[model samples]
Target: MKNWLRTTLVTLFGFSLLSGLLAGCSRDHHADWSADDVAKVRDRIAGKMDLDAAQTQKLDALIAQLQVLRSDIKGTSNDPRAGFATLITGDTFDRNGAQKLLDEKTSALQQDGPQVITALADFYDSLNPDQQRKLRQKLERHKSWFGH
Candidate 1:
């Protein structure tokens, strides 16, 4: 009985350690979009596309530009729950407050939109025909997820 109990405890402890290690290995958290996260994305896409150095460099530039734009847009955002609560704190829906939030978001988009477009265009144009086709296919496969 003593030996059996010891064996069971050992097995359970080993499994628990393995499960913890495996859980830690998965680094694909989607919440925070930091520079490191964007670089990982660039690395993954670059691998998938088999990008040459020049194309990879363009991709890097595009990814960098996107990170900057994301930071800029995110800077304009506050806690959504708090913002919405403020809007509804009064008896009436604060249309003006809501409009102000919308305008801020829109302004951020307008400010960063052109630079993003340019970077995207430069990266896409740098791709050869085969790479472009692969990119289009990948986008098509994922487009439905975006409600397109």
Candidate 2:
């Protein structure tokens, strides 16, 4: 009985550790994007691109539009991991429920993603060829920073 108890306790401890690690891994670090965060992003991009007054204004407008769309989408979105805890805790596996959650996320993306892409495309088209080259080079350098 003592050996059985010890084995059960060890198994429980292992399960607890696994669940904790899974929960931590599932967290979204960039889930919340506030206006202040958007401003910081704009400033960083502007600094890298050396945007003039007109480009700065356009970029600022694009950032504002994106922030508004993000807010709208976030307001209507559910917790992405709502049912994940149950799965981690050894509850009945609901594959359909998990698929539904993914579908909801995809639908949300489809709703707002097109507008963002269009805005970014417009901004990119507005850049001069030299500015475009500089931006491309800067992006390539960032790939190296990520160990790519």
Candidate 3:
């Protein structure tokens, strides 16, 4: 039971991380994404999931919250190694600095991760059995695409 719970949490975390990365990749480096941008992404995900009206609304709210969290993280990030230039310029390694960055990231995750996970799990649980099966199959197909 504990293993299953851990696996579930990890999978959900990976999904959230992948979604954030993909969203970031779609935008210009310095461009601030508007609410419409977030809405479009939420719409695309809802379409893929075949969510109903209520589900779509719930998803939209959840995505909005997550976008806020992402923005907060980006806005407060102070890592000197954030840019590629620092890596190529032979910058001195600062172990304490790295640890501080890691601590900040972990703190952010701890603060917001449970809310994201709970929203996801609630939405997933609300799916019909057939929809759940379809989702499982879709996940399996995606896994196979990466030779997992």
Candidate 4:
């Protein structure tokens, strides 16, 4: 009886945790967006990267392409499993589905990976070595000041 009770409690706890996580990632948290949405994200990224008007326009274009690629890879929230889990999950509990989804998300993340890296490289390259060092110090100081 004790063992059965313990197992039942564990199952209930796991179910509750899964439900909470799923609820957290529902429609309100989805990243579905149009080209205009990418423009806004691009604008925010531009501000973060200290980009000028021309650079912002270019970044917006790149973001639009990345958004399309991302959508294809991530799929709709309804089937948020990279387009294959729904099939596999029909027969089993789909424990492997989580790992598969994570792998796909990681792979999809690489879609815009190089461009973002190149953009950051270009920004740093444009700055003098002294400025780079100063920027690092400023960031560290800010982090320290915030008790982070």
Of the candidates shown, which would achieve the greatest TM-score relative to the real structure?
A: 1
By the lDDT metric, which is better: model 1 or model 2? 1
Candidate 4 local Cα displacement, residue 76, angstroms: 6.6
The numbered model that scores best in lDDT is 1
Off by over 4 Å in 4: 26-32, 40-51, 65-69, 76-92, 110-112, 120-148
Q: CA lDDT of each candidate?
A: 0.76, 0.73, 0.68, 0.62
Better of 3 and 4 by TM-score: 3
Residue 15 lDDT in candidate 2 = 72
Report RMSD (Å) for each prediction in the order shown: 14.6, 6.5, 12.0, 6.0
User: Whole-model lDDT, candidate 1?
Assistant: 0.76
Residue pairs with colliding backbones in model 2 are: none
Ranking by lDDT: 1, 2, 3, 4
Task: Summing lDDT over every window of 10 consecutive residues in candidate 1, give the lowest-scoring window.
Answer: 22-31
Tens-digit lDDT track of model 2 for 1-148: 6999999999999978976875675565657766688778888988888888888887876776676566554555356455565554555656776687567657767888887787777788888898899988877878852433
Where does candidate 3 stray beyond 4 Å?
Answer: 1-32, 78-92, 144-148
What's the TM-score of each model vs. the native? 0.70, 0.62, 0.61, 0.51
